[model samples]
Target: MTQFIVSLAVFLALHSIPAIPAIRQRFIRVLGRRPYLVLYSLASLAALAWVFHAAFQLDYVELWPPSAWQAWFPLTLSPVAFFLLISGLFSANPVSVTFRRGDMKPGAVVSITRHPVLWGFLLWAAGHIVANGDLRSLMLFGCFALFALFGMVMAERRNWSNPLNASTSIIPFAAIAQGRARFGIDPAMILALALTVALSAWLLLGGHAALFGTDPLAMTST
Candidate 1:
């Protein structure tokens, strides 16, 4: 629990960097853009690993007994969540979360939501909270849900004045529906879907149990 809190704090702090442009620019100016981005990305991954490590150390105190539907909910949502996660990370997405510079275009996923990564994270967190139904899981996933919500709001508010945002929106597909944004496939979207499918298959076929000590398929069966 102590470790979980500490790691959560570090994760929150690290993520907050992107929410603050001044701080991010300062670090970029000092480290150089590409190096700063690379280092930050690595640190973000390390912080996430620490969060999972610490969370597994927590005592399981059930808030509600697990149910088949509960477990299945997250499993069902996992593909879409991961697809958004991968596609958003891969796209240039000048309007939202992006890991690298590209052709200055928001990809197909971004046309759905400028904040696809955050929406993916939100779905992941909310689904897991329902699936696990435990204090530890709540703490772990709840923070993530809140973070994703906060990120979406912050990103929208911060970028609201930018002309690029005129073509995008916070709600999924709203921009495209309004004809503000156009939808088109991205190479990254294809790769992301392929990777998500492989990942989902592995998780369903006992890999999740191998890593996390529980099987969603088994959970749904019981």
Candidate 2:
């Protein structure tokens, strides 16, 4: 429990650095944008892996009996989640966080939401929370969902006057419904869909259980 708490704290503290523009820019200047992003990704992954490991070390306390729908829910949601994740990673989103800062256009994904990446994380955590349905998992994935949501709020405030925000929104589909942003199958969408399919296949087949103990596609959830 102590290890879990400490790991989560460290994860939060590490993410906090990029929330501030000045600090983020300083690191970018020192390490260069690409290197900074690479380093940040590796560090964040390590922290997240530690969080999961520590959580697993703690005792499991069931919060609810699992059901087939809970298992199916996340599987059905996998495509959309991965779509947002992949598309967001490739977009040059001026109004929110993104990995690629060059070449990639603010196309279809940004049309859905300026914070697609955050939304992806939000869904991923939410799915895991439902799938696990335990005290420790609730704490772990609940915090992750909250973190992604809070990041959206921060991004909104951070780029309040950003020109792109005129057409983009934090809530998915809001911009498109409001006629603020356009939706279509751009290159990013094509790539996102293709990769999403591939990933979903691998995970459903055996990749998920291979990495994590639980097989998500197992017929019995309870």
lDDT of each: 0.85, 0.83
TM-score for each candidate, following the candidate numbering = 0.89, 0.90
Model 1's alpha-carbon lDDT is 0.85
lDDT of 1 by residue, 1-222 (tens): 788899999999998875566777788789997898899999999999899999988888989887788888898888889998888888777656766453365677878888888888898899899999999899999999999999988887787787767777788889999999888888989989999999999988988899888988888887
Tens digits of lDDT, candidate 2, 9-95: 999888776556667778889999989999999999999899989998999899998888888767876678899988887776766
Give, for candidate 1, the lowest lDDT window spanning 10 residues: 94-103
TM-score of 2: 0.90
Where does model 2 exceed 4 Å of error? Answer: 17-19, 102-105, 219-222
